[model samples]
Target: MIKYALKCEVDHGFEAWFSSSDGFDEQAAKGLVECPMCGSAKVTKAIMAPMVRTSKEEAAPIEMRQAVAEALHKIRKHVEDTHTYVGGAFASEARDMHQGLTPERPIYGEATTEEVKALVEEGVPVAPLPVMADKPAPAVQKKLN
Candidate 1:
């Protein structure tokens, strides 16, 4: 399937889908296509960049990809080196700190989505950490090896 941006003589712009390039031409030539706003049959293809999508590997060559990977690794290393890992007690620890029951300090830990949401809803500042390539998958909260 192909999609095209179309414009009428009156300059009404819209989008429509076609089975193929020939289908658009056939429909336009027969005056089957008309502007929904102005009802003009004099519609033509409007100038538009083709929609293209590529995976990370295709979008960035090896050198560019290596640079990105190195940057992410450095970020992970910084967070690991500077932040205290609190295991599964993250939500309670954060709440205690916010309520002045505990001293505030840099920390990284695990918390479920619900816990994180509740913390945010109650105005506690929190952000998710980036995924590291060494990890199988990201946890609900931050943790480092």
Candidate 2:
């Protein structure tokens, strides 16, 4: 199946599907297609770029994935090196900081789901770490090693 962007003489734009390229020409010649909004039969195909699909390997090249992994690793490293690791005291520490009970400082730590929900409800800003895997990717590990 093929889809084409069509425009009428009155400049009304719409789309229609055809079985094949020849089918579109045949239907258009017989005035089977008409502008949906203006009801004009003088419709023609508008300039369009064809959509192409590449194989999975080509779609996400190794270099692209490696660059993304490297970026995430840098972010995780920065957070770990710069932010205080409060461990299980995440909820209390975050709450204290928000309520001005403690000095404001960047922190990264573990929090229970209940603790997280409560923090959000109380308008304390907190978010989960984005590190997906406990172990770094083989590429990153190799670079470190």
Most accurate candidate by TM-score: 2
> What TM-score, computed on C-alpha atoms, does each candidate reach?
0.51, 0.55
Which 10-residue span in candidate 1 carries the lowest summed lDDT?
136-145
Model 2: per-residue lDDT, tens digit, 16-100? Answer: 7678888889988997776655345688999988978766434446677677667777777889999999999989999999999
Instruction: Tell me how far the alpha carbon of residue 134 in candidate 1 is from the true structure, in angstroms, after superposition.
Output: 2.4
| Count of clashes, each model | 0, 0
State how far residue 119 of model 1 sits from its true place (Å): 1.0
Can you list the residue pairs that collide in candidate 2?
none
Ten contiguous residues minimizing lDDT sum, candidate 2: 53-62
- After superposing candidate 1 on the true structure, give the runs of residues whose Cα lies further than 4 Å from its correct spot: 1-50, 53-58, 135-145
Off by over 4 Å in 2: 1-57, 132-135, 142-145
